[model samples]
Target: MDDLFAPSDVSWTPVSPKLAAVRRVNAAIIFGVLAIVALIALGMSLGWTYGVLGLLVVAGGFAWAWVLIGRNQRSWKYAEREDELLVSHGIMFRQLVVVPYGRMQFVDVAAGPLERAFGIATVELHTATPATDAKIPGLHPDEASRLRDRLSALGQAQAWGL
Candidate 1:
């Protein structure tokens, strides 16, 4: 099954490790809010004991997600081929997307507030078919820009049959 998604000959490029850190921070913020809410709500409705228990459960969930975020981030990789680009990720339900240069209508590089704070960007490829479009996240800004330009040039060249 792994062999089916990942080719042995291709040299895969991994996203920045900062992705895991950013994800962990995001998870922490979410879980922290949940914990506070749970503690307050449960404590008021039930008892302080139940509130602490709820907070514990939320903490456990965050711990599990923290591990998963690292694994998931490590799994993300993209490889550029002669004619197409391959992006693959996911630990359990893996997905591999192949986007042909000729099929790409546009490429986008974007960085949200958090992503910009972390100095990372996402590169999205748009095709005529929405289902064929794909995005790679956690790339450095420079790499994202270079990829966007390169992909645009490649797509144009392929479209022109040059």
Candidate 2:
């Protein structure tokens, strides 16, 4: 069954390990808040009936966090082709965004504190539509820069209709 859906010629690269950690960090923050609420609920269930209401609060928090963390991690994936960039990601929804070499306007390499700690960077590709920003996250800093350069050159050539 796995062979039926696999691409015969395409090479699949997994997301960076640091990206997994980043996703986990997001989950931890949410779960941590829910843990606090759950504790409060336990306190109330003992004798303070008012604390029973805290269960709903904790449950709601858990649900919300579950949705956020679970959904985001599930829908994130990407691939770089010879002439185009493919990004697939979303939370609670799946999106496959393709940016052709010709439509790419610019590529940016950015790093934040968390990414820096992981020694990873993000490569963002901007197109004519400001709202449609495509990004490849969790790249090594050097790889991100090289991709940026290559994408930039291809975008320029494409802009000239070459």
C-alpha TM-score for every candidate: 0.97, 0.67
For model 1, the run of ten residues with the poorest summed lDDT: 1-10
Write one digit per residue (lDDT tens) for candidate 1, span 1-162. Answer: 678999988999999999998899999999999999999999999999999999999999999999999999999999999999999999998999999999999999988888999999999999999999999999999999999999999999998874
Q: Backbone clashes per model, in order?
A: 0, 0
Q: Which candidate gets the maximum lDDT versus the true structure?
A: 1
Tens-digit per-residue lDDT, 54-138, candidate 2? 6566667657665565556545566667777767766435566778888887788888887788788889889889667798887
Estimate the overall C-alpha local distance difference test score of candidate 2.
0.71
Best by TM-score: 1
Poorly placed runs, candidate 1 (over 4 Å): none
Worst 10 residues of 2 by lDDT: 1-10
Tell me each candidate's RMSD, in Å, in order: 1.2, 4.7
Q: Residue 76 lDDT in model 1?
A: 98
